[model samples]
Target: MSVTGLPSASGLPDLRQVTPVDEVGVNERVARFQTRSIKKESKIEALKMILSMIDLTTLEGQDTPGKVRQLCQKAIHLHDSMPGLPHVAAVCVYPTMVGVARKALGDCDINVASVATAFPSGMSSRKIKLEETRTAVAEGADEIDMVISRGAFLQGDYGFVFDEIAAVKEACGDAHLKVILETGELGTLDLVRRASVLAMHAGADFIKTSTGKIQPAATMPVTFVMLKAIKSFYFETGRMIGMKPAGGISGAKLAVHYLVMLRETLGNAWMTPEWFRFGASSLANDVLMQLQKQATGVYQSADYFSKD
Candidate 1:
């Protein structure tokens, strides 16, 4: 079967042999945290703290080639327009658009990210997935955002999911790989945690939530669970993986909350774009709005900030 197409179980090796971590240990710990106490005030405080740390800017899914080119121009303009303007961590786009972003961003230090491996639905064969990742990297994508095999993962086929991620990582070469858990479909917090651990063990450099294709994406509870997983994984492996909570993460307050969780859970190490990012298109406007509020002490209308 082609890597881009789905593989039947009979045609592939059992993934259990390649997995590195103890599944049971991960599952148990994740379950235990489900009932743990989380103070409302503490949560709010965490959000506020992280918001302060954020570059508070992002650009996603520019769509057309011309539009992406324009977005890149805007980024350059923003770099010069705003005083103390912190550069966005990366510009995210569809895999096919990687080249456009690369050219648009030029020699700028900002990263160009692409979603690959049958993103939004990881039902394709491993061969196609690997090629997609390789192709994206070859096209100058500094980072790859690939989705996990949610169907197999939900069915408890942990080994299949594990192997897929490992193969994709191998294909990524030097580019950073961000594995999207699609946490919205993972159902329970325990499952989200397990998926996070599984991705990390499979050599994921970052674990992300959602493709923005499903509902209830990137919620506080879901992000909290993933962050805890990151902390635990660090304890076990001594490697600090990145975290990205995407999908419907619009508005400054909500974005700040995500940052809050990252800071409180992972500390200062994760505040940078290297360790954290917001995968959003509309979020930039919200962040700008909030910044305006901070600067002028007044809320601004969306119309004031251009959506392009």
Candidate 2:
């Protein structure tokens, strides 16, 4: 069902159908955002805002209870040496580590987000996916980051994708759902745009760009395409769908550039942490280094900030 309460069979566009994206035009438009210069004061503010919008993520198969706990601690206290720093929006972990994150968090302002739907690869049955979502929420996940079945989607099964998202939305209960499109695997800008619309119509609170697993993840041009989709969706439905561009974003300069693109593209209304997020494991440290550089007038080493 869509936000306007329309049935998928009646309202959704078929996956195989799409208007071709102007690749050169999108590339040129995204390049312009990088040229807009931000002053020092504004840069500092943007850096902090970027910090607050990050989903400090560790989705590795080797992730342990201690690592999740450590990440949760980092989420709570991001470089205590720098006072007045806001924590990252959330600490995202695998479903199995949500309990450790919850216990470690212990009622902080930060949220605990867990990835389900077999994550990274949505190759499982609907029964297992729903169970994964429910179990994550029951284990104290404040937010659920669910992956879409790209295989089903690419196989020309748009209904399967819509139904899977709707079912996951139902299983989320109170937890907000951030649907990962993994646009890198989607093969084209048209597909990325269509997937964004499809996810939002199916009840995603946020449409994430990637799971950070695929190569060439979360590029500026790809993010530009999705933001355009989001802007159009908001215009038509009067419903603000959040956007998260995970992976391949590491430097402070690039992070601030993303803010520039986001603010200019969606305006100030969509600039809050509620509507934006960065799902990266190493970005926090880089942001911290930039903050320290701004404060002390010198470049700082990675050792200064705690490792991710």
Give per-model TM-scores.
0.80, 0.95
**Pairs with steric clashes in candidate 2:** none
Tens-place lDDT digits, model 2, residues 1-308:
22322345645654444445799998898889899898798988988999999999999999999888888888988999899898899999999999899999997878999999999998899999999999999999999999998987776677778878988999999999999999989998988987888898889999998889898799998888888888987887999999999999988889888898898889999899999999888998998998888999999998767878
Error of 2 at 142 (Å): 1.2
Q: What overall lDDT, based on C-alpha atoms, would model 2 receive against the true structure?
A: 0.88
Give the distance in Å from residue 102's predicted Cα in candidate 1 to where it truly belongs: 0.3
Quick one: best lDDT, which candidate?
2
Would you list the clashing residue pairs of candidate 1? 3-125, 3-126, 3-127, 3-128, 4-125, 4-128, 5-124, 5-125, 6-125, 46-260
User: Which ranges of candidate 1 are over 4 A from the true structure?
Assistant: 1-62, 79-81
Tens digit of per-residue lDDT, candidate 1, span 1-308: 12321334423332233334444554554444444453455544433333333322233443688878776665555424335545567777778888998998889887888889987788889999999999999999888899999998877677678788888988999999999999889887767877887788888999998888899888777777788888987886799999888878877666655665566679988887778877776676566665556557787887766554
